[model samples]
Each structure stands twice: as structure tokens, then as C-alpha cells.
Target: MLLLLIFGIVLLPKASTLKCYECSSDASGSCKDTEKQCPSNGYQCAALRVTSYAGASKVSDINVKSCAVAEQCVEGSLNFGVSRTVITSKCCTSDLCNTQLAPAPAKSTPNGKKCFRCDGQTCSGTLNCEGSEDRCMTTTVDVAGEKITMKGCASKVMCVGSETAQLPGGIGVGLSCCQGDFCNSAISTRAGLLLRVAPLVTWVMFS
Candidate 1:
């Protein structure tokens, strides 16, 4: 009876985990409705959509569905002059709950706010902030002993819990977010926030 109780206890958590659809739009025809059993620890079914724009023309849209943590279900946006990216996410606790795509972000209009963006090694190009992008953001990481930096505008949600959101680059990120124009001109931030948005950051920086 004692051994049976222990085995039941060990199996209880696994039995309660949810099943969720997992796929990405980036992969050709990858959005087929397939499900994955999320771990019983903390994961929930998630759906995320990312939209990018260049000036006035729509550039690309990406969608992903999988298991997510509580922090990953958030909305955020970024703008850096002629380029902009918006993110939206949803999470549910039921099996196969991410059957549909997450909502897309609304179009952003300029709010007269100003920030600095990087061009090559120069970090002085004035960028116009838009919509909920009320904060200036900058990310720095050491690449081959050279610190590579990226600066731009971000929504408050993007900055929240970011210090603890460590992206998997095997390098420390000097992530900073502040209010006011050119606040990112200096690379320091009050550590506060989360959303573990790895794909969004990578797309913004490399795309």
C-alpha cells in the first residue's frame, strides 16, 4: 500500500498536464493542428503572432503555437524608424486550447516621441516612437569580445520583467529601458520584468 501511494503521487503531476497544439508559421505548412502534452510543472497552451512592417507596407507575419509559461502571454511592440514589429500572445490551461491563431496587434501611429536607433556602429540616428512605444530600449551582448548593441523604441510591456527573461545566447545582455527621448543613449536600466520573448528579439535584431 505504501509503494502504491508513492507511485500514484509521482504519476499525479504527469497525468494533469495539458495537451497543446505546437507549430510555427515560419516552417512551410507547419501550422497543421497537432498537439503536445505540456509538462505539469507550469506550462500552458500558447499562441503567438508577430507582424512586421516597413514604412507603410506590410512586410511579414509569423505565427507560433506551443506550450508557454505565464510570463510569455503578453503583448508588446517595437519601432525603429522605417521598421517596426508587433507581438501578441495568448495562453490557455486546457488541452489543445491553442487551436487558433493569437490576435494580431493594431496598426501603430507616431506619437511624437523620439528615441535613438543604431546604424552600424553609430548609435545616433533619431527614431520616431509610435503607439504604445513609450520607452526607449537597448540591448548589448558581447560577441567575440566586441560588444554588439541594438537600440530602439519599445512598449512598456516589452520592458517589464525583461531582466529575468534571459534569452539563450550564452552571453549576458545589458538590457535597458527608459522613458524620454534618447534615454537609450546611455546603456543602463532598472531591472524589472518578463516575457521570455526569444523569437521576437532575434527577429528584430537580425531581420
Candidate 2:
């Protein structure tokens, strides 16, 4: 009887669920204190802050706390001419570990790297890359029947094969990264189609 009880105890599964706070808002608002159990695959608690800027002024900020996958713990920024978006994420493995807010994004100065950027109908202007931004990037997003293209400098982490595989846009978003100065200068229709096709296909299959 004692042996049977010990075997039964060993056979029981260990608890894998994590409890984390969950909230998302476009404005810089407070997160609720309530904690909820995370899904089985969600093994980490994450707190994130995303700030958007137009020119030199901040336009919007988003704050979120929730269960996350390991891939979601990336930190990077994207500059697209008139607008820029920066993301900062903090992650912990323990339950309810994201009780505090993530740290704000650090300010960066120009680092002498330059890349071509799109402005209206022209792509003749150059943008000075800042901080760890050593790569050039081009992004094409097709959301709600509107096609928008953005090209500028990007950090190494935000480039190809890094943690930030896809951006935060909802659907039909495509991103391509490359190196060299003014690498993203040309944005042909065929190139745009190629960049956006795979993501659009994935979205179609999933949705």
C-alpha cells in the first residue's frame, strides 16, 4: 500500500500555469491589480511599453501587461520618416512577476549612420540613424484597404532573423530588412508585392 501511494504521487502532473496581470491600452494608463492564470504555453509574465512619436513630439503611448511567449520579449525601435515607434519589454518567469511597469525607452542621439527615407511621393531624403541602429529597413503595411510604405534605419535586433520577426500591426503587414547606406532607396511595385505576399498569405490561411 505504501509503494502504491508513492507511485501515484509521482505520476501526478506538476503545475505549469502562471498567473499574470493582463491589460492593454493606447494611453499611458494604470494596469489592474487582478491576476489571471496564464495558458499552458504562456510561461512568462511580460510588461511592455510602446511609444509613438511624430517629428520630435510623442503622439501616443501603449502600456500592456500579460502572459507572453519567449519570443515576445524583444526590444527595438522603428523610424519611418514622420513617425517613429519604440518598444520596451520586461519579462519574468515567476508567477505575477510583472507587477511593476517596464522601464521607459532610453533617448538616443544620431550615430552618423544614414539611410534613405520615404516622404510623400519621393524617396530622395536621408535619415540619420541613432544609437544601435545600424541596419536599413523597409516596411509595407496593408490594413483596412490602405497600403502604406515606410523606409528608414533600424537597429540590428529589428533586422532580419532577429526576435522582432513581425511588427505589432494587426494584419497584412510585411517587413524587410537589409544593410548598407541607402539600401532601401528603391520601392518598386513588384518588390512591395513580394515583401507583402507571404504575410498576406499567412493571414489569409489563419483568418
Candidate 3:
């Protein structure tokens, strides 16, 4: 068990992205006016990180409302107030990046070559290769969300599990491709370390 735990700890660093959560709404009840909102009435937005595993990050949004009767003459059911909340996730790095846990590529034929592709908020693209036994033929990865794309002979291929530009100071890292940690990290970490330890854990846990 201890060995498994240690193995997992080692693997954790190989994860592609971090899982974070944010509130889309709150439960402050109802408010009479914007001024009555928690901000004005003494309230703040809620922060939440749902999960951070397998190089993935998630954000959750919650609602908050506040309400009160301004006068006794008003009808019992006449008063109702509400507010909206925005959900956001934190930047996932180290293990969470284009080089790790990238979104699955949608299967398609580009330039008469078969490949995978994926599309989502601020991102879209495809990957193809010249026939079997040949290196990747052609690949296109565009991250419009981050205003970038990988094309031409140098185009790199990978998956994206989460969008980075959505996070603070992460737009810069959005240019990467591939999944499961950056290639550099994978080479030095997964290939060099995690790969070495995974078998031992499997042996101890299953064997």
C-alpha cells in the first residue's frame, strides 16, 4: 500500500493539468436592489475547485441571492431579488498542459490522411499522417481562444484536456500542444521516473 501511494505521488507530477472550480452562483437568498447585494450588503463571491486529478481541472459556479421587505404595506409575495455568478478554473501547470491530458482528437481525414481532432472553447484543430509507416503527414492545432495554432512541417501534435488562456497569466502557455506534461517534463519525469516506478507499484498492488 505504501509503495502504491508513493507511486501515485510520483505519477501525480506527470498529470497534464490541474482541476479547479469556481462558483457560477451563490445562496445568499434575494436582495431588493443591486446595492442590497452581498457586495453592497456585505457579501463576496464564492471560490471553489472541484477536482485536480489525471491532469484535469474543473470549476463550479454557484448562485447567491438576498432579499428583504422594505415596507409592511408591500404584498408578502411582491419582493424578490437575485444575482448572477461566474464560474472559473485556475491555471493547471506542471502536469496539466498541452503536453499532457489534452482533449481527445476528433477522428477525421485531412489531406487524404487519417488523424484525430478536437474542438472547444478557444480551441480547434486536426492531426493527420501520410499512410501507415510514415511519420505524421499533416497536423493543425488552432487555439483561437489563445490566438495561436500549430501548422506546417513544424506543427506539433497533442491533446488538450483543459483551456489555459481562461486562467490568469496562462494565455502564454496556451501555445503548447501534446498531452501528459510538456514533452520536456515527460522526457525527464514520466519516461525517466514515473515509468520506472509504475511497474513496481503494479507488482506490489496486483502481483
Checking candidate 2 for backbone clashes, the offending pairs are none
CA RMSD for every model? Answer: 6.9, 6.1, 24.0
lDDT, candidate 3, 74-167, per-residue tens: 1000000010011222222221121211122122122343222222221123333321211121122233233222221112211122332222
Off by over 4 Å in 3: 1-50, 54-164, 169-175, 179-186, 189-207
Error at 67, model 2, angstroms: 0.9
For each candidate in the order shown, give its overall lDDT on alpha carbons: 0.66, 0.66, 0.21
Candidate 2 wrong stretches, greater than 4 Å:
1-14, 26-28, 143-146, 166-173, 187-207
Q: Total clashes, candidate 1?
A: 6
TM-score of each: 0.74, 0.76, 0.17
lDDT of 1 by residue, 1-207 (tens): 999999999999999888888877753424666768886668888887767666666566777788777766767676655466777778898888788888878766788889887654466778888888889988754444655566788888777466224312211234478988888874432211111122233342100
For candidate 1, the C-alpha RMSD (Å) to the true structure equals 6.9
Among all windows of ten consecutive residues in candidate 1, which has the lowest summed lDDT? 190-199
